[model samples]
Target chain A: MIEFKAAAVTAPDSGVSILEPTTLTLTEERISIIGANGSGKSTLARLINGLVLPITGTVEVDGLDTVKQGAKVRRKVGYLFTDPTSQLIMPTAVEDVTLSLRRIIDDKSERTEAALTALEEIGLGGKGDVSVNALSGGQRQLLALAGVLAVTPEVIVADEPTTLLDLRWRAHVGALLRTLPLQVIEVTHDLDAASRAHRTIVIDSGAVAFDGDPAEAVKFYRDLMFGRPTRTADA
Target chain B: MISLLGIYRPGTTPLHKASAGLKSLMLLLTVIVTMMVDDPVTSVGIMCACLLLLVSTAPPAKATLRAMGIIMVVAVLTVSFQLWRGEVERAIDVAADLTAIAALALAISCSTPMESMLDLVSRMVRPFGRILPPETIGLMFALTLRAIPEAARIFIDARTAARARGLERDPRAVLIPGATRTVGFALQLGQALHARGIAEEAKPERTEKKPRRDRRSEKAAAKEHAAAQATADAETSETPLVTYSTTKPANDVAGPTTAPEGNTSAS
Candidate 1:
């Protein structure tokens, strides 16, 4: 039910528009946004979680206005940034997930139990007390997912969550994301990842260049991304 | 200059065998005693004892000397200052006091693992009852200790980058970006704390729950809770915890480039 009505986002300092006026409704359970770097894909994903606000127009999450209800909207929309290292704020894996439940379980013992359960769910049970800095890239990303998942948000927004990972870890993270029950919105450059989504949107120069089924959208995106001549499908 | 906090050196000395908490306690006691004693002989005696203790630990002499160089400089300066003020005996006492303090500090650095030190501090502060969760404080102290060197390294790198861009003379080059990077680091740390589930609000809940229990049961409960927590922690820590290895591998080598020369003539 997330909707963006004529949304236009611009960089505050440069006053350079990154996302052009666009109206779109995200009603599907899972949607992937694909674009090159500086193509404003991340900005669009961030808007869902109120990490970035539109300079013009309105963004609403399930009828809640993002600008006025940012805190509540953030609670519903969990964000996973590209860098797990940057996103993981806690010293240990268990502690990080436990932090998300701070609003829910006030008791230290209860909070610890809940956090441990969340970690166990993610296959990181044995690493509850291990320092976050020591984990491998893949493990950290999974830990980051566990942190976001513990919050029990309605919508999960990830920005290139697998970009830094190796092939195995990348697939592992992708599969993990695919399995989540919540509404998923992922911004990625990975064509395979985009193909797995139910719907795909191609963004270029801060505007939607293509929006349709994954296969057609990917094809449109590929041509647009590589600067190939406009195909009949694009038109 | 990269140096990690705790990588075990190959040693089977008595100092190594002593419990980290006991060792820390002994060091604290010795430092306190040194501060109290005004007599030159007692100060000198404590200094000698500290040196003997450090030697018994059997770390590399070069490492010890290099590490203690700053303390030695301080001791020399104290001696010189006292002598300049025409107090020869006082100078000797001050020098001996500085040496003792330095020796005890070095013993701490050499014998105790950083994790154990953190654990000891947490245990010592546990009775404070949620005014500060000892574990969170321990983590903060560990992070602050770890970040000091890291922050210095970043500052140096930033300064070098600014110099290379020929902005060395501009105060903004050194100050603004350094502050920005440090703030970014602090934000990352705050985020990490959030991820771990340790918030400032959780502390008061433990205190609120304290009043219902009888004093004896509370003590027993605390003990049981600590033991269970320890057991749970031990199971997770069974694997050899990865240390941030400071050693550089052979392949990744880069040439040292000088910072760009600044233009002071612009004024």
Candidate 2:
């Protein structure tokens, strides 16, 4: 379980506070964060992975303090960025996934085998040898996920993982995420994706304005985003 | 304009098919030979052979000439410098040797793609075992090749933007922001690397033993077969799919009635 206690995060230059002092515990199996632009949803996700340390207060993942044991915490909490292009460090798909397994699988043959298996799991079995720069946006995102899952982290935090994808791929990636055993925390602007999560937290002005069932949270977010009371539970 | 070094022109010429290790080795050997053979005839012969090999690869002649022009200018400067120092014979020999070396280097680059070069390096370093991850090094090379051009483009764009804002005269307006933006890009890249599980801490050792099968040879054959199949498929497809075509225009054709009259007219 991950817990953020009175976490307040600020941008490096602007001195603008992104996440206000707020304590939140993510004990559920699947949690979705919903917010408008500048509501600090991404910042909150970054905080979980130690990508952004809190200016005040503390964040702990599985009792591992983020500030003191950031690298350890990050090992447990795998992060997926919005852009796969940015995430893919290697030139080829297989090579990219193989990088993650390098520490875990000591033998050269085992690493290749594990990487291939991970690619096959993501429906990209034959693409291990292909250059990463040539992959389609959807394929790249899936490959990125394959790379992340190769590490076998306990918590998976994705920041708008499917934001750049088309409808078909967005659904494909979302479905894959739903099946993962790891505790998944996703920050998304997509209302439909938020609705599917077990719990949802809506952030407004750097604070949690609403937190409860996915349906209620979605309603609150829609109302806040569109400046009108959205029909509850269905829309 | 995109430089020859940056742009990749696809082809299946013999030069393209040559192993990167062989090409690199040949390039190095030629350079050494050029330096060793100070005789003018030997130098000129090596340069001609390099040029011929480069030409046979079928790269844009303009690119070859441009590279040659740069080399020649440098050679001339070196020769002039030697002459100024009262070393006439040394100047001619040095200039000739330098020309041969430059010609040979350009030929190698023209013949081999960046990815192939990286693959060769990776393969060459595999025997060393865990000192440096070949894949990581290859990826670094690819990223460097890709990012250098991108960073340059970004700098140009930033300069243009700064100039438009009437801050062109201020050095800080250009250099500071450009540096900041580049650093920001690098940070994003680093974060992206971390997110994808390719962080330094995540380097996994090669667990599998090398198979008896010649894997590199198999890979090359497989790539060729795939390319052949793709080309055949492209030829067979009746309606050529313009892969980059956006949804809006294609939508217009699929559902003519849905598009507004003005939009359809504009198209």
Candidate 3:
């Protein structure tokens, strides 16, 4: 279970409240967050893994406080960034996965073998030595996920993981993200993807506007966006 | 799309399987020999031998050579300068020496895995462990490798974006944004690393007791550690993890701690 107790995020320079003080407990198998641009959706997802520590209150994953036990909490929470380039830090595909396994696997050759298996699992079997720079956007995202899953994290916090991809890749990655066995918390603009989640949270102006049935949440978000464009225009 | 510096082509060649440490040592020896060798012909032969050794790895020789075209051009310029000084023999010697060293370095870089290089780096810094944390250095090294290509790409994109805006020749137009973007990129890289928990490895552990170095060596180790701190401090300074927070008021504003660096795809 993940819980946020009145967690708030303030801009480091502007001193503006980004994420308003909010409290919520999340235990769903698949939860999707939807909001408009600058809606603080990513901030909310990042807090679960200590990527964005709150200025006040606390975020805990399965009882481990994110700030106090950031490292231990990170070991269990895998974050997938929107841009795969920065996340795919290694030169090649297999090497990237092997890097994640280094903490757990000691021997080099064994780690390489396990990394190869992980690549194969992601349908990138023949791309072990391929430069990460050469992989297509969709493929690179998959490779990033492969690196994350190699660590076997209990929770996956993905922030708009497929926005950069094409339509074909969007569907492919959407399928992949949906079938993941681990607890998945996704923040996406794709309404179809958001509707697929078991529960959806609508974030408006840094606070949880609605948290409930996916269809209802999406409907509320739609109304928030298209329904009253003038009201949200300056937001 | 490969760097001239890191175009490792793994194969069954002897150089491929040979240990990186051994190759590194041999490369060093060759450098030492180059300094002493008086005959240009011998140095030229050595350079060719090193090139042939690198070629034996079955790397895309054409691409590697093309990638390193800048180095070759610089070598030619150096030799030309020596020739203009009316020292033809000295020019040949300089050319041979430069080619020999570059070839040898390329061969080692091609054959060695980056992981081994990082391991060797950490091991080399172990003696200075008290003052310089090996894990931080190792991570920074890895980040540097990744950043070079990323920076190059960013420069190109920034230039293109400038051209689109009709300010292609304005130095400020290109340099300012390029630098700001790079700093932003560095911050994002730092954040990514922090999220992955790589930085935690450098922190002192409170959960476990570590083995003591040695009663006999402690005095010596501490003496060495203390002595080295002065030298190390002169060469080192702190690298900021993240800073410079500002954001426009919007529902989508990232937390102030979040770098406003553009993470959007150039595509």
Candidate 4:
């Protein structure tokens, strides 16, 4: 479970709030955040992993405060970036996954085997030894996910993971994300994916414009994007 | 860069069978020997042997030639500069040693897997785990290997972006953005490593004199060393039991990246 206690982010240079003073508890099995560009969806998602620290207020994962207990919080929260090119740092796919397991499995052979297993589970069975640079966009993302899951984090905070993916890969990755047993908090533009989450939050201009039912959240996001034709600006 | 480093081609040649540690030690010895030699004739002979050994174990003609072609240009420039300085004897000596060492290094890199080398290094430093964890050391090597190709990619991307914006042939436009992106990549990598909790737990101790081995421990180590050498000698074979493709894979294929030369798979 993630809790935000009036947590907000302010740009150091501009002194503008990237995320408004907001309080919310995220405990759903799957929660989606949908919003326009620069609307603080990524900020909110990063807050879960302490990737984006709040200037004021507190953010906690379970009982661990992200600020004070960041290392401990990060251990329990895996972060997936929009680009796997930066995330998968090892020379090869299996080596990358093995990196996550190095602390867990001390023996080199054991770690390698475990990493290979993780890769296989992520639908990259024969690609364990492939160069990270050679992997297709979808494959690289899958490898990144495998690397993250190898550590077995309790919660995954994904920031627009499917933004750079193609249609087929988007669906493939979406299905995989949905089926994960652990809690998932995803920031994305895919309305279809956002609609299928247990709960969804819509951020508009750096504040949570709507939160609750997934369908309602999606509706609100669409309305905000295209505007509601039935209502006047005053309404 | 992928073309230069971590560019281990998969093969079951005799060089591939050599242990990374033994190969590394031999490479050290080769460099020391080459540097000590004053006679240009001896240096040339040794350099030729090194070149031949490299060719015998190397990949296809085209790729090896391409890599060597770049090296050749550098080698020629160095030799010419030395000659211009009125140091003909020094020129021959330096040029010969340089070619030999470079070939020897490439041979080592082309045959050994990166993981194998990293594992060997990590275990070599396991005794220093208290001051610096073996895992941390291993992670350092992994990061170094990852950084090479990543930096290359960043340069390519930055250059491409510059060209796209009609800034072709402008070194400042290409280099500044390339350097900035590379630095950004490095910073993000540090953050990623921290996020994964790879730092500060051990609170790395200050570098100091290595702990001396006790007399008893030294005797035991000698015994262990003898046993390991005997086993290695018995296992050594010139035959290539494992078949591998001479043709290169279009994509980075599964196999060892770089190994220290002479094919001994260290236990």
Candidate 5:
């Protein structure tokens, strides 16, 4: 379970508010966070993996404090970035996954075997030797996911993973994410994708505007976007 | 894409099985031997032999030639300068020597996996392990190898984006975003490393019973550890700005103006 105790984020240099003090307990298996660009939804997802440290209160994953026990917290939570190029740090797909298992499997040959297995599990079995730069965008995303899964993290926090993918790849990746046994907390702009989540949270202007059933959350987000012009101009 | 260093073309040649250390040593010997022999005929003969050896490895022909293109330019420049100085034998010797070394280096790099080379790096730095963590040094080497191609891709993408706006000639437009995106890439890589626990795992454990190195080594190790910590802190602190600026929409109703870099179509 992930818990945020009045956690808030502000720009370290500018001191501008990025996230308001918000408390949330994300225990659902599939939770979607939907909001406008820069609406703090990404900030919320980042907090779970300790990517963006909260300035106000504590954020914990399974009782491990994100600030104090960051490495441990990260071990339990894997993060998927919007860009796979930035996420994949190795030359080849297998090498990238082998890097994740470096600390786990000390034996070199055994580690390579395990990495190949992980790739096979992700449907990238024969492409292990392929350079990451050669793979298509969708394949690169899948390779990134394979790297994340190699660590065996209990929860996967994906931030707009499918946003860059084409329609077909978006469905392919979305279906893959849905089938994973691990808890998934995804932040996305796709309302239809948001509706598939068991629970959805709507963030707006650095705060949670609505949080509950997926359908109702989507309705609230849509209404909030459409109703904003009349309520507040130049915002 | 142009192939750069550390690009291993899988093959079953003897060069592929040779240890990186041995290959590096051989390369050094070849350089020294070639320099010792000033005869143009011998140098040309050695250069032909090296080219033959490289071909025996069966590397990707097109990528290897592209990688060697820069070396070819350098060799041409050196030969031209010598010829202009009215030294015919010297020009031939210089050209052959350059080709010989370049072919050997390319052969080794193409046949050997980067991980093995990194392992050699770690082993070479083992003597300084007391002052500097060998694993950390090896990790840095690996990251550097990975960054070159990534940086090239970033610059090309930035140029493409600039051309799309017909601003390709404007240095500011091309360079500013390129620099920012490179920095963002570094920060993201740092986060990925930290999240994967690689940063933590790179530091070797010390036992209380083990004898301490000298005071200078201890201080150096502490300094290295502190620098790594500062980098991690900076990554976390500076990451919010990247996220905010990239994801921020131009208009309140419209979505973000641009997607993240490298949003290539899958078709």
Candidate 6:
């Protein structure tokens, strides 16, 4: 479980609050956060993993304080970025996965074997040795996911992971994320995907505008973005 | 330039089979030998041998030729500069030596897979493990190989966007965006590293030597390391594999966005 106790983030330069003093506990297996481009949804997702530390209060993952036990919290919470190109640091697919395994597996050949197995599991078996640059955008995203999974992170916090993918890839990756057994908290603009989550949180102008059933949260997000009264869900 | 790096092809040729460390040493020796000799004939002979070795590996023809073309262009410029100075023999010697070294470097890169080369780099740095983490240094080298093509793509995209806006001739249009985007990409990469927690655990050990912790604390640290390793072993039993099935071939019709020379996939 991830907990935010009056946690809020402020922009370092301007001292403007990026997230309002928000206190919430995220325990659902599949939770989606939807908001406008700059509504602080990404900030909220990042707080779960200590990527963005709160200036006001504290954020904790499974009782481990994100600020104090940051490395440990980060180990438990894997982050997936919008663009896999930036996330993939190695030349080849297998090499990239092996890099993630470095902290876990010390033996060279055993690490390679684990990485290859990860690639196989992610449907990139034959392309393990291929240059990461050569893989299609979709495959690259999948490979990035594979690297994150190789660490066996307990929670996955994805920040608009499918934003750069096509419709087909978005659906494929979305379904894949939903099926994963671990807790997944995703920040996305895809309303349909947001609606599929077990719970949805809607952020509007750096505050949680709505938090409830997925369908209702999606409706609230739509109303807020389209400049309509957010009471449409109630109406 | 990106193609000049990380372009390895798997093969059974003697050069391919040679250990990356041996190949790297040979490359260094060949360059040193070439530099020690100012005779045009010997340099030319070395250059020919390097070319023979490179072609025997049968690397991608287009990419190899492109690299050779670049080497030839540089050689010509150097030779012409020497000729302009009324040093004809010096021109021949300098051009031949330059070609020989460049060809030899390319040959080594083509024959040795990048993973092996990275391993060789880490092994080389193992002696200085206290001061610098061998794994981190290896990661830095791998990141360089990975970033070159990405940087090239960013430049091309920036230029294309500038051209579409009728600002192709304006250097600032491309340079400004390219610089900012590269910085942004680098920041994202750092975040990725932190999130992945690759080297975070071992980071403090490098600094522990400077602080000179007490023997008891050192023992405690050793115990912590062992516990971490034990936890890692326990976790390895759970593969953490997330499997999925796709409907169609995942291959993109647009092919790789990078240049053909950048592919270098074992064929």
Q: Number of the top candidate by DockQ?
A: 3
* Candidates sorted on TM-score, descending: 3, 5, 6, 4, 2, 1
Question: Residue A4 in model 1: shift from native, Å?
Answer: 1.2
Candidates 3 and 6 compared: the better one by TM-score is: 3
DockQ of each: 0.05, 0.09, 0.26, 0.12, 0.21, 0.20
| Residue-level lDDT for A60 in candidate 1 | 90
Q: Model 5 residue B228 lDDT?
A: 59
Off by over 4 Å in 5: A228-235, B160-169, B202-267
Better of 1 and 3 by lDDT: 3
Ranking by DockQ: 3, 5, 6, 4, 2, 1
Collision pairs in model 6: none
> What interface RMSD do all candidates show, one decimal each?
13.9, 16.2, 9.4, 14.0, 11.6, 13.1
Error of 3 at B40 (Å): 0.3
Top candidate on TM-score is 3
- If both were scored by DockQ, which would come out higher, candidate 1 or candidate 3? 3
Runs of candidate 6 exceeding 4 Å displacement:
A232-235, B81-92, B204-267
Q: Tell me the tens digit of each residue's lDDT in model 3 across B236-255.
A: 75523121112122333222
Cα RMSD (angstroms) for every candidate in the order listed: 23.8, 26.2, 16.2, 23.0, 16.7, 18.7
Cα displacement (Å) at residue A202, model 3:
0.9
Per-residue lDDT over B137-186 for candidate 2, one digit per residue giving the tens place of the 0 to 100 score: 76677667656645776688888988999988887777887888877777
What does the lDDT read for residue B142 in candidate 5?
A: 87
Q: Where does the lowest 10-residue lDDT sum fall in candidate 6 chain A?
A: A226-235
Better of 2 and 3 by lDDT: 3
Error of 6 at A48 (Å): 1.7
TM-score of chain A of each: 0.97, 0.95, 0.96, 0.96, 0.96, 0.97
